[model samples]
Target: MKLECQEKHSEIRNGEIHVYAWFFNRNVYENNTNVITFNKIKSERSGKYTCVARNKAGFDSDAVNIIVTYPPIVWTKDITFNGINRPRIIKCNVSGVPNTYNITWRHYTNNNQLVRVFNNRINGVLILPEGETNDLVFEDSGVYRCNVTNGIPDESGNLWQSKKIQVKVEGKPVLAKPLKSTFIGHFNETSSISLFVLSSSNVTQAEWKAAENRNSLGHGCCSSTVNKTSFNGKCLDMSGYTCVFLIKNTREEDFQNYTVDLINKNGRNTFDISLISSGVPEVPSITDIYQRQNYIVLEWKPTFDGGAPQGFIVQYRKKKDKNWESIRIQSNETNDFVYISKLKPDTEYELRMLAFNRLGNSSFTVQFTTLFKGETKDVWTQFNLFLCIPIVLPVCLFVFLLWYRKVLHDGIVTMTKVWLLDTISIFLVTEMTYIPR
Candidate 1:
């Protein structure tokens, strides 16, 4: 590529004229040259070129633009079809040396069958047949190819360039098999329910909603009254041809007619499923008990939740006390054990724990006694005394015999008195004292 600047004035002013050429503000040639030549031009070399001729008198500058053209590069903007029977436009972006080009549209079906859509020398937009007479259908869903050519070839010498546009015809969601009308879920536990779809048709969203109903009233489960407000649960999973809904930490209020709404561009469809409880929880049993000073640790194995979440109510009272103290424990709080503190030591207590759900409660009574603080101390003291007696008595007897022999050799008659006095002093010093634990 070459760019030249011609001198216009004939007046020979001052000094020899110096000419310079610049491409996009960078000097490409200098010194008495009015023409700039670019070797091996590329797309990057296409831009503005400026030429300046300057003398001792002054300087004059001019600029011109240069464009390099290549073969057509084609791409399409994403297009969404509202639903079956909707008219849609697939547009492509095309760029090349010549603005005029021939566009060819082809579609590949699911079975890899090729079908021509259109072939014409026109702008890069294809409009599908619209109206009720020529409505789009699910069969029209496939990969649409947009190919363009303008005689110019790319660096690889390929005359045609193409882009694939995904065309999907959305419709109402269709279930593969009818979902079960009823589901059994446990309260205070995670429940996962799913449904299969034959043709999701681009299911964009799924929602789970529960109908208004009264809370479960008694051991007779599954009874409902329409006196409450409806609520929504989280839609756990929505992918491809399946929808999974989750009821986390299920509650009594969750047992109702649940509506699963599947939504798409075309429309939405709702499926109904009734959730019911299994039954009343089983009676809780105490598995183990640990007694401490002024406190007791009770451990129990969890029983059946009876199709619903269940918590525990612990009731206890001192054997002599007339009133019972109660503690409510939530299902999540019980890690197999309950700590009952601030109880009187050396007192007999009766405890009963019951598992209750929305339906009813079942219980069993147990009795345990807290140990007196000094009781453990006394045991330890006795243990220490028992160990000391055998060793201490032998040592004392040996020492007394030696002293008696020495006193007899010295002709002293007070050996028995001294021995008795020493024995009494040792006993006094070795007396068991209460040790705080």
Candidate 2:
């Protein structure tokens, strides 16, 4: 609690000093007119108060002796995770001073999301569920923590503890068919990726990444992964795109490989790309790149130019790996809308696509990040400028200054003398005339 002093003063030479004081706690007034009466009360508000009085000579007395107190700790009585209904009870030790302590619980959601459950206190402890001591119950489950604190009554004031509770959320991952790989000549064509995700768990995220510059000697561009919400997964680059994923209902029997082949569509075309993706489709020749939300838009020109395509499919895989896993992404956009979007941030991805026509399908792939942010390079612009002055120039100046000091100490000298010899002997005839003068 805190008190704020508000006093007005006036003087008039009256008889004796008469002091009047009043205290307020919102409407209800208190007659604590005693000059030095105060207690160490635990309140929500405490501040200074005013006392007014006239002296014998009509001088007024000022307010004095303000008091301040600390507020009591807030006690939480219940713990709720995500929602109101309790799912399963978690067994844990329930130990705390029920008289002063309060407990609150935060529950994890079925989809790995965190939510706080609220409840009004019944007894002291957050009304534990059925049988267990501190029988914490949860609807959805995961790792959860509890906040227990001994509020105001705990005179020592330091009373808060959090205990982590691990939950065994019962569920499995759902999965879709893995994509097939493509090959060009003996050099190995770039691989592509495609898939859908469904799960007992909330599989709300998809990702794809590949090793970079992996020739035979191998840099680091061989492995990548993909994640998506039960639909077209991250579009991969044919250049380097291989990875796996597990969704809600994934089981032990699901670990396997999927493969696809590339067949030339139009024999007359130099590189015929047949929609070989699926069903009724001919080969495509030219490919186009476009962008779309969370995916790369890939379309190819029909094998027979001007012919409408049934549909377009993009393919990709991680670079330089034996497994050579593949995934294919589908697109509804026309051949013109070839842009791909929502690739992994700061990643290198390759892409290829097959266009379906009356004859067959044509396939082509390339590599680039879906993100427009170009790769960053090691730039020394700012640091280089600083080093030139503070480090380079100063060191050079010190060297030159030392060299000059050495030259000064070495002591090299040059001198000149004045003397008249043979030229003055010829002028001796002037000596006699000068003596006479």
Candidate 3:
């Protein structure tokens, strides 16, 4: 509040005119002339007052009134609303000059247009306090400003004081991306399953359950962790809170369906993860391989199925390389043979096989190398026997016939010489078998 007082005289003493002023009927200024002012004003300063101008002989008195006007203060804080709960009401606390203060509430719509809102402002019938909103909805969430003014003219404009309240509508836990239904873990190795849960608040309570019992996973073999963050397209514009479960030193018994229950003030939801353990199938040993043009057909004894219906995967590469190329066979039944084609001619290659199922994959069997071309030859083969027999038989027959003729000629010459000496009439005595000359 400001005030001015002055005395007009024909002459002035000490270059100033003295005036007296009384605030609320009390003398507050007596030595000042031409001006009396209250620099700052408060509510308590509202009252009647008077100012007097005095000279040596006479004094003039004038009556005046002073009224101090100020702005209202709004008592407010952050507000949260549970959309699922009934009778959701928010209160606005305001204090100022009692009858002079007017508290008005306004909020911007989605299009940013200012609109007056009256949400159950009546008393008794409506639980929401005056200048507040009731039955909160997601659409009602925004920046709410309470403008308090006493309609009194002051340095500050029409708005005396303003306060903003951030209101958010929180609903129950809704699963945006739930836990995976199936998980695979290797024997003796640690495995983890993670779930992405979206909630309105940072705090969410989670529990593990299995086999119709609560907390059955136990602390020694199982553990879990949670992290809160914001996500973009996949989370549907909501903040994503992730929870992960770890199984240590995985065993066969750990292969089962585990449930995770999440709860908050909004609501509750549950999801499951099925864990399975897989081991390598038994080593595969080769029985025989038939060679074709740049291809080979392989036959083998079926190895152990490793506790599941299994299929085979064949991998091969050059003998000098460590990187292997693979061939996949999609079948659950055991296979006794597989035909491998498209091999490089004259190139040495090492090959291996593995068995796999939905549970897990097996370790690769021991590697075997393919034979190069023209390396297969046996002395007992039919081609070698026919070539050797014809050349050897004629040489043996010629040597035996020469030896028999020499022996027969020598015996016949000796017998004829002895018989001719006595042989005038000897032809009748001994009949000799004729020898051809």
Better of 1 and 3 by TM-score: 1
What is candidate 2's TM-score against the reference? Answer: 0.22
lDDT of each: 0.66, 0.37, 0.58
Stronger candidate by lDDT (1 vs 3): 1
Could you tell me which 10 consecutive residues in candidate 1 have the lowest summed lDDT?
A: 223-232
Estimated TM-score per prediction? Answer: 0.37, 0.22, 0.33
Tens digits of lDDT, candidate 3, 1-437: 45666555566664543446454557464535445556767777676667776656556777677655556656777677665544545556665554456555665432344434544232212133222122232434455666666665446565656677676668655444322477666677787766666555653566667745556553222122233222111222333465667888987777888887777666666666677665556656667766865577777676765545677788878899889988877755456777777766677778788777666677777888985463345657655456544554454445544654565666754657445533622442222222222
State the RMSD for candidate 3: 31.8
Across residues 372-397, which tens digit of lDDT does each residue of candidate 2 receive? Answer: 33334346765665444455555554
Question: What lDDT does model 3 reach?
Answer: 0.58
Of 1 and 2, the candidate ahead on lDDT is 1
The number of the candidate with the highest lDDT is: 1
* 1-437: candidate 1 lDDT, tens digit per residue: 77777667666557667645454746554534776667877766666777777777887788877888777878675555645544577788887776779888886653345644687938888887554421233435567888999888887888899898887656676543223567777779877666665232556666767655432222211111121111111122222355676778988877777767777666777777788867778888788777765567778877888767899887778877889898888977848777788876666777778888888887555555444242245676776666765566667766766776686677766868777757764664454332323
User: What C-alpha RMSD separates each model from the true structure?
Assistant: 18.8, 24.3, 31.8
The regions of model 2 sitting more than 4 angstroms off are 1-87, 100-102, 108-141, 153-160, 170-437
